[model samples]
Target: MTNIAELRKQINYHLYRYYALDDPIISDAEFDQLMQTLRDLEAQNPELITPDSPTQRVGAEPLESFDKVTHVVAMTSLANAFNDEDMRNWLGRIERRLPTWYPRDAVEFVVEPKIDGLAVAIVYEQGLLKQGATRGNGLVGENITANVRTIKSVPLRIPATPDGPPPPTRIEIRGEVYMPIKEFNRYNQQQLDLGERVFANPRNAAAGSLRQLDSRETASRPLAMFGYGVGYIEGAELQTHWDALEYLKAVGFPVNPDIIRTKNFDEVLEFIRQWMDKRDELGYDADGAVIKINDLTLQKYLGLVGNAPRWAIAYKFPAREATTKLLEIRCNVGRTGQVTPYAVLEAVNIGGVTVRQATLHNFEDLAKKDIRPGDTVLLKRAGDVIPQVVKPILEARAADSMPYQPPTHCPDCHEALSHFGEEVALFCINAACPAQLVRQLEYFVSRPALNIEGFGVKISEQVAQAGLIHDVADIYTLTKTQLLSLEGFAEKKADKILAMIDESKHQPFDRVLTGLGIRYVGSVVAAFIAHAFADIQALQQATQPELEQINGIGPRIAESIVDWFSRPANRTLVQKLRQAGVTLSSSKVEPTAPQTLANLTFVITGTLPTWGREEAAAFIQDHGGKVTGTVSKKTDYLVAGEAAGSKLEKAQTLNIPIIDEAGLKKLATE
Candidate 1:
């Protein structure tokens, strides 16, 4: 192979490992270095860069509108099974249609998650991605090739694993493109902070992200694909559904890892039952589990019942909804000072949980829904999200009830509220708003923030309401006797809380910044700002341009930081925190540790004997070494302990040195 071709192959292999398989044998820096080299090589020899090159996934020119795609094989739907009986009925139908030669007991089934996402069909020609489209009308769909190309999980070239299955001449794969629930939440909050309208759920977020006209916009979203089945193929024949999924996985597609192939019907139901209860644990949202006849030939024989396939069925989870009376409309002032509306509902059971309240989302959504007190509202509890008011039963509204109004003032402080530019959320701009401060206090002690152990939310609210603490900074100045005077505080509990508060004062500046509850400044973003600015004084003095220049510090975060520091009351609070002996700079003012492992890079995996992963990473950084997520040839050492899985194996493969916790400490102190 030519040098350029081999280089591109190597890059594609690493990309497959990193994106498709979620395992990497290279550090991010090494991967970046490889990409940079390829970019330079392509610049030197422009014609060498093909459309399937790793460098060519993004930067497609924007189209006025998406083109249409007519499917060679229709993207058919599946009938749904709400319970075991429904699933049994489907199996019975399949049994009745089965040829006499094919025994019913010999039938095998493949059960996979029915991802609550956008259904898409992607085509491949000569192992390279040809085109991708949304499942528009079964036989026809919108061409979203440009947008799909940007999804890293959707491989540009097939057979991601070396020496895997050879490419088919042409193949059509069907999959669901989805956003992880956690990523969706974070992305939605970021959008809201940037004054953009946010998606109500992960499924909507994935769909909206995948359908963006600009490919770069799609690239920026965290979209992933899981191949479920095949629509059409030439030069390849698959006999079983399980084999098809396996073939898809071998050829660079990420299939659902939880797919189970079983001959027993009871096993299928058991898998579905387990998944229903554990739905929240799946990183991505799934509305149901799909059961398919494993034999492909049998599927073809027992096919086409209306728009749905007769051989497959979706076992949908019970819907989480209940009709509850809207007792009242309430407003809550959040830490960022956004006053959001919520519903005070009469106690109703939704999905086994007695939900007393539901999120109205924001004032704009409330106005759009026209939900009023005394109306019966349909509540939906989706996984871990706060139960939401889907819609009100307009016919069930009381004659005396009037349309609910969004709060005109801050609910707690009665301060005048205002809209932020074109944003829908109303903000209480009062710096000393008591309700906002209580939320700030609650957040300041959260596990991801300062981590004031034993300092619970109820106590934070109690102290704030009792006039013991005015702001988060005042937490450091709280007296033991004052805490003991509270409802739940005993002498022992009060002392422990005081000690935790003192310990929190020693928390790094990033944690302190996170605890401050600045708008758009999440813990991860706060860390970037803290590292870039070094000290509270430097951060306070940083202009919008200076803050925005830092990596990952966006305009919204920069503006929020600048606006936060501009307030005199906030400045005074910072001074109070500093006076209370909080470490405000990047690190404590002290002598530096020995730079023993200055030039070294390390990878940590599994449970360490004497140190946790974070602790070991901190120790390495204390002596000036870098720690990365993956093992690579460039990695100086692998700090490993019991059950160090793939990273250990990769390190061994590359002949990289391995060290235990003791050896790691020894090297750090050398």
Candidate 2:
């Protein structure tokens, strides 16, 4: 039998690789096998399970409230330097405070991106994570150890590597916890698809995700950390700030790889300029560049002025906001019947981009902001993406302005708008509403759905306006002659679009399900439903409870699925799609081969070399295996590929066997 301690060490190392370094040596399935063995051993010998074991990352109950924790060393804020003049002035101030022995111009400094996130201090005692707290008021914070442990990048135990330095008696690692931009966008999209309020920006999303009372919820969120500095340290001798960062990295903390050490302030200025132009390229949000004195002794000598450090300054990028007057507020109904309120703004230049309109998010947010017509509003364009109205400048509000009211009728179709139970936004529930039909057609041809080439938002709108395509099924009825009649539809373009539309008929049933625009049934959920039922007919016949029994399908999603199929129009559309020769079932027919993986469960993650996750999962199911979204003791294998995240970590910790595409193929043959 494998030693439990050795298994734990191996799992932690792989986690550090997958999370901290963004690299993994083994597939998820192989890792799960290791975890399962360890779990079996620990289950049989309960005393062998330790706090630092990987299994302890999750499974904590929700807390009613957090307890206050006082910091040994205050997590101070940094002084701001907006320009070269400000930087020079700050350097001069630091020089004046330094002793004569320290050469002012020769002092080394470290420059790193100032992450826009929540600051938290992680305390490690005897090499294990002891406590984690937020930097509330800089002096004291709420203890969030359980939630922090759920962050895969944050190691539960320090000195995780065998060759690493001995355990520190105690240390407080201070870092910013943030959600990567990609993950934030994905999460916000999920929220929108579910008819929930979306986060305004990544920073807000990170803060909200971190402060969840349920650690399980936090674990579900894609949160990561980058250690920048230490709050307190005992037992270790750190000579300089750079040395401390190196020590943190050696002990399994992820430090930003873009950090640079330089003695020249000119280089620092250049670095800041480069980052200002390239910050969007980074995975996480960065609002500024932090320049700190590299020497620990010099930092101590030039320490605290008020609450900010004298030896360090943050060179903030110019604000991406512009003040504009709210001309009016209007609502737009989406294909899914979701109604969103937006602000019509007097044109203002934000980050060199002209902003004519901004999103107000929803009616609830609009009422909360108390924004009215003729009020001055702050509009921000973070990363030059979508522009959003921050808030109304109450002082600049028109004296006669009244509180804005949500529309009682659909903006486009003029039908009565209705709000769903427990939902914030109003919806235009009429399926035949022209606006809804147009948007729904657009979604049907979207990349994640049927992926009809040459079919874009403008094209979908034109086709709908011409009465060529009213519903997703009507798309197959379009003729090249009808397309050529529309503006901008030449012979070549029309022919190409017709060909693409024909090509989409072969799109798998899962994507067809997604293209149906069922509420809360995005690609992930659609795939689960498609796999569970094998065919659209089976899915349509499934009861709400039967749908909910699928791993990823919750009560709300199951209800949505059942409600959608219950409608006569939807059933007819599915029938039309089938009549049009569209694939309405799994492409892989039930295999006659021996059920090699019978009664076994597998979880798939990341991108495979030759097959997509869905393709690989379909193969497993065809061979009599079950696929689930999460890894657990019940999971027999985890099919992992490149860039696997939390699932990979969890599999490794549980000692579950992991396999790659090749390994999976081998298992299928056996």
Candidate 3:
């Protein structure tokens, strides 16, 4: 029989060291090999797979719902310091308080970059990741274990030695959840293509993604995290925050190396200044620096007051702010016809980048902010959000400064602008505006859209300028030879573009709808519309009330659809697309037969051993069963997989049916 107890104990200790100590000495492959061995051993000796074993971290039980967990020690928000004087005052307070508590001659403070992201806690029992939760109100948070498991940096099981001592029985690590700039950019682009409103910054994106009701959706986005503090621990003792971070790294968690232990306040100040100048160079966004007392005992003595800890204080850099003169304001007609205003600024540094221009949203926003050329404006580049003018420096404004006025015609096609009855934006009605055509063509060939492989920004512009492609429909008319003649494109690349365009013709109707760049009609909504209306003509004729009946769609979405279809130019573009031979209707003329599952409803919990959650949901949906979000009396079945939670109990309470994958397969087949 496998020494399951021994393996569990050893793995638990290493996990504590890695996640809490950040002092991993072993390679990731070596750690994985050990875990695999333990898993294999447990497989052979089934009885040895205890609930606390590493092998049982994620198992066959499905969750009916997650139980709310309250924190023993509440997570607190930090106080902000906006300027140098604020920083000095904060340091003085700490220095004044330090002598009264400790006998040391000089106080040492550890300064680390303050990550601007969502705060979360991960709990492990005997070295296996058991639960993950958001920092909701500091006292209690929503459990998000499934989504946390998807983060690659978070270790699934703590490492163990063949004969090493057992790991800590319990431990909790706290960290910031954030998206890197590159990932944030890609995600926003995807959202924009799908017609969803873009996130203002990475912090907002991380928070929103983490709080998603569906863990599967949260896992789909590129989210990363770093452990910074220990929330709770047993079996091992840690003296300092830095030590805890080192132990965390030792097992397998990724810890920020930028955290430095300094003996003097001046050094801490220097580190803060250095990071401020190089903030953009870092992989993640840092709004400020956190300074903490090194001794854990001293920290406890200082205790908490309200939401902040007296032992720790955040020294925020002056917001990545700059003042610049707006030389000119111009409107750019977007592919969807919204006239967006942009300010040409006298170059200034904001968020470590030289910003020369910033978006003003729309003409309505310009009037709302009362922005104008020749006025000094405060600017900021918030995470991966666009550089924007935060406000005008009223005191800095010259006497001659005047409010900016929006243009009466489209800058690209010179078409007269017209406003919607209730909307703030003035839109250009021209379908063939050069700028609009170029933007649409670019969006069409983008990887997520039609994914025309070799078509790039320059090539798309050239094609439009040559009148070879006026709309997405015109891409089908281009031959490989004609594409090869374009500047900088080679024969091989041209062949790829043509092939991609050909492949795009077979794209599903939902994708086609999204590529149309309809206002307020994003990817999810488009899919919902396609599934409901079935055909282009049916969708075009859908009344506002009919469209509003769908679960996710609202009155605004219905109005946008009505407005899009009502336009003569938009209707012409649709005809052009139809002429290009793109499939304009759902191919599913007859719905798939309802497989004895028409009225059944299922709620899934935990990780399925054989198939992904999406695959399982697809199986349920295909057989005419509905996959509901939560467990309730209406649910006919609760599919329990590994790592099941409170959802399982709720099912039992309501007397709802529960089944495993094997049972589900049987039901589907029957």
Candidate 4:
């Protein structure tokens, strides 16, 4: 005989703590246990189920189509301001239109981040969330009440608290439904692991998640919201925009804490600058800052202009995304002989930088995106990160455009391209290929591989073109006289380059393994293989079964290892490295530790205080724990850090134990 009402109230309180306040007293597993108990009681007593109940958020059936919702007051967009000058011009227009009694300097503005998400309007009747709809046009939108109910931050029924006003007769709250960057990354990683099509960015992920026909699918996505303004309200006498925000917050609506009210335009500018610098530090993506008149009276006086309000302006930061025509698709052979596709764009400006080229990842990704040459594609660049093609604008694509076919031969050396088992990328197997030689040399001297300074791409290309270096092994045989023959090789520069190359001979065997750029052997795998084998000779002699016995080395990686070692050229290259006096084994070696967490699978999320994710995962693996990307029923524990997102939520829902950095350390010692 479970009290269903009490259980719903308790679950809702925990939801508010976890979602709205970012603090939870009990662990996720404990919360889920309580939820399960409530769910069981509801299942036994179906007559007691209500629309506002926590269990009623996700429906069993999928919707065929969304019903249209007509807004009482039109949801208009804001006019843009690219610079301070544009903002001043907008302010000037507002000042001129306002009544003469209103003071220019005294006009207050409510400034908030313009979240890069889908705009939605939620209607509340008697403090119960009645309807939710997208801003499809200005007037009519598709009803998404069933999906919106699944969002934990959105209150299903507003309850009166000590310092808050009672429920209003009717109210319309407008907000941006967004996916946080952390959650977006987790979701994308899961998609990649599952070999599914991943979303290009957080905005796309949120939009797709919210528009799902199945409410259960929507419930699975980590969607949150922050109320910005109102469409209409009844039985509420809000005098100013700030007051309206406060009232909305008081009535259990989530409003951004960063929202500020300032009369001085200088303060507004400062706010904009601060946010522009720290936008990435935020959990969610914000494209710009929205400035609106604080006074409801002044807003009415200013009125509407075209489709936007004259009293409000959106001061956008530099463009992070834009549309451009993909002129052509080209392939480049990497040091590892992997062929990658790239897009040549019709020079588009993104974030004040001209983006002429962007990576298509690989042929599989290129095909998955189906971006054909002559298509208008969405280009995105985040901060200093490399620009990439998000996807093609299908509606704007040429009618006669066909699917792109990958080249059968290497674009640079004309060697036949071939793919290994289960690999998505095509590889050029010619070790002596001129393009491969240059790329391989560049990789061998790279910071992560050999830590050689002054041996950049340009230098590597020059040395290769001069025939002074034919392979990675040839780099050690270069003479001072031969280097001086090159155009930019002065006495001091040549000596420095030689010294850096000399210093790299003492690098550990693991680095040498990584420097070789063997397929499926990255820094982590190299470390594992180095620890397992006594030296390079022992590793080369190891069989496929021996390689597969090591944890994390699957059948594919084992096959790659055996195949690489079996090659006559690769074996000769290893002998050349040894003859050059390079280190072939680890200096400090210890016996393997006890396998305390042998059967456990851990999923790590967020930022740990002293350990990075990779470092923490390494420690876990060393102590015999398996680290995975996604959280599931098989997950033993979730290693949570600051601002853990969807993984934490899913872990909690699945009743998996959640541990902090300290707890993980304790587990390692135990």
For candidate 1, write residues 1-670 as lDDT tens digits.
1398888889989988887788999999999888876775675467777988989876488889989999899888888899999999998898889999899889999999888999999999998899999999888999999999988888888876787799999999999999988888878666654445667778878989888888888887888889998888899999889888989988878888899999999999999999999887898887899999999899889978998999899999988889989999999777778877788999999867899988887778888889988899999877666688999998888889788888788899999999988877888989889888887888889888899988777987898999988878888878988988889788999888899999988889899898887777878888776655546886797778666656578787789889889888899999999999987876722237787877687877766777866578767766766565656676899998875666778999999999999999888787
TM-score leader:
2
Clashes of 1: 0
For model 2, residues 1-670, the per-residue Cα lDDT tens digits are: 5688989999999888888778789899888777766665665567888988888777489999989999889888888989999999998888778799987677999999998999999999998899999999889899999999999899898887557798889999999999888988888777776677888888998899889999988988889999998877899888889998998888888899999999988999999999988877887788999999999988898879989989899999988888989999988888778888998989999777788999898888889888888899988877624689999998888789999999999898888988788777899888778888888888899999999977999998998888887678998988988998999989999989989989999999899999999989989888777786557876898788656557789998989989999999899999999998999987774747567877677888766899976688878878867677767787889998765666778999999999999999999898
Q: How many backbone clashes does candidate 2 have?
A: 20
Angstrom error of the Cα, residue 128, model 2: value is 2.4
The lDDT of each candidate is 0.84, 0.86, 0.75, 0.82
Across 320-425, the per-residue lDDT of candidate 4 in tens digits comes to 8899999999987776677777899999887667999987866887888898999999998753335789899999978899999999999888989998667676
TM-score of predicted structure 4: 0.57
RMSD versus native structure for model 1: 10.2
Q: Give candidate 4's whole-model lDDT.
A: 0.82
Residue-wise lDDT of candidate 3 within 1-670, one digit each (tens)? 3366776666765554554345666767777766866765664456666655555434233356656879877888887776667777876776676656476545667888998998899988887788889888889987888767766456666643333334588989899999888888888766544334456578878988777666666766778888899997898999888788777766556678789998776777789899988887787878888888888887887777677988888877667778889888887766676677788999988655789998775566678889878888988886556787878888988899877777888898898988767766677768888888988888777765666776778888999887787677778889877777778778888877777787888887877887787776767787776655545776787678666655467898888888889987778777877887776765553356455565687877766789765567667666665565567766799998875667788899999888988888889888
Return the lDDT, model 4, position 99: 85
Rate residue 432 of model 4 by lDDT.
Answer: 79
Model 4 clash count equals 0
RMSD of each: 10.2, 7.1, 9.8, 11.5
**What is the C-alpha local distance difference test score of candidate 1?**
0.84
Which regions of candidate 4 deviate over 4 angstroms?
160-163, 321-378, 383-386, 390-403, 407-670
